[model samples]
Target: MELLRSLTIGQYVPRASPVHRLDPRTKVLATTALLVVVFLARDFAGLGLFALFLGACLLLAQIPLGFVLRGLRPIWFLLVLTLLLQVFFGGTSEGTVLWRLGPFAATREGLVQGLFVTARLVLLVVATSLLTFTTSPVELADGMERLLAPFRRVGVPAHELAMMMTIALRFIPTLVEETEKIMKAQMARGADLDTGGLVRRARALVPILVPLFVSAFRRADELALAMEARCYRGGEGRTRMKQLRYRRSDALAAAVVLAASFAVLLPGRFRW
Candidate 1:
């Protein structure tokens, strides 16, 4: 589906922007901090400040606003569903009712809750997307492994986990491409993937899914063989080709994110 391809999550966009040039570890840490702030935000004022920060980050990254927003297309249904549930089923019974449908009522508190929840979800997605957008799969893996290295003393397989995550992210676009190919092939063979009710359309996907799964397995097997042939082993004693180093820019970026995090909390603290 075209919608699937529009998803920018886990897809790196090569650019000569400050955000992209920052150390991957900085981006990872910054993203995590912002995610925490998103959840901590309690009102529109807090969310608006964070939204402005996010917009600034997007601008610094040189990413088109429309491209960044297109990632939300596939999740529109989920967003709408969440809002509807919060509007009708949320809050106490004492709030002013704005609308009523049968026994369900939309209250003022419910509306505020719905909007806040929706904004949080959107901000979360955008923050995560920014991380993936700026960092390449290899860089992400290296950064993740380094970040988790301290836990190695506790017997955590940090390198292996990071490698698995890298492989998964790297294959997202590949899998999407393969799916598109299979869909086109099926259509060419007179297999209808559209023009049906929800159930029927889902049933129509069987033909495409079967071959896609087979292709996925075949690719995995080939990757395993290639790795084996190259004598690849677990991350024990592994050395990176390009070691990650934090620069002055990275420190500046981290400081900015920290300031923004504090700003996000201030609104809730002061109730302003």
Candidate 2:
């Protein structure tokens, strides 16, 4: 299915760029900070500032804009639906009426609200996709484990949690590929997956899901056995092939991110 091709969240692109060279922990924390700014933003100016920073990060990563945006193709319908809802049924009813359709009338306030919400959603996706595109799953896991290690004083199992999260992220592309293969195999067997009503199409997908689930479980079992064979214990006493260390670049990057964050927050906070 063409749907699988648009997914870029789990796929990594290797490049000799500043973003890729930074410490993984720094990137992870920066991503978290940007997401916080995205959620805290209340107006277009704040969101626009965040968008500008995200665009710069995209450029530094050496990833194609087209490839990063391809992840949005699958969610176009969702974005449209969200926009339409906010335009038609916003929080307040008092504003200049733009258009009317039966019981629902689009208002100026509703339009602004719709655009703001949609922008946030778009920025959120691009920010996260940038992280995965730059950092491999292994690096992500290592960073997360180290970041969470301080919480190990409690009953938390940082290593296991990171391992699980990494494995799940790593399996996304594999499962997508498996789903495509199953879909094609069914298509060749005279399966009519297309050209059907809504209900009929829902029924058509059932065959694909069953086989896909079975395949996922089979793969999981094999992986578990393989790990056991290698005596893969938890992260305790395990050393990395390449230990992560924060370099001078990481500090400069952090300083830039901090300044950019304050710049974004202040623009909409107090008149500048």
Predictions in order: lDDT: 0.89, 0.89
| Model 2 accuracy (lDDT, Cα) | 0.89
Ten consecutive residues with minimal summed lDDT in candidate 2?
1-10
Error of 2 at 202 (Å): 1.9
Instruction: Summarize candidate 1's per-residue lDDT along 30-130 as a digit string, tens digits.
Output: 99999999998887988999999999999999888898888888788989999999998887898899989999999988888998899899999999999
TM-score of model 1 relative to the true fold?
Answer: 0.97
Model 1 per-residue lDDT at 38: 95
Encode model 2's per-residue lDDT on 113-225: one tens digit a residue. 99989999999999888888899888998899999999999968999999999889878888888999989999998889888899999999998999999999999999999
User: For model 1, where is the 10-residue window of minimal lDDT?
Assistant: 1-10
Q: lDDT value for candidate 1?
A: 0.89
Candidate 2: where is the Cα deviation over 4 Å? none
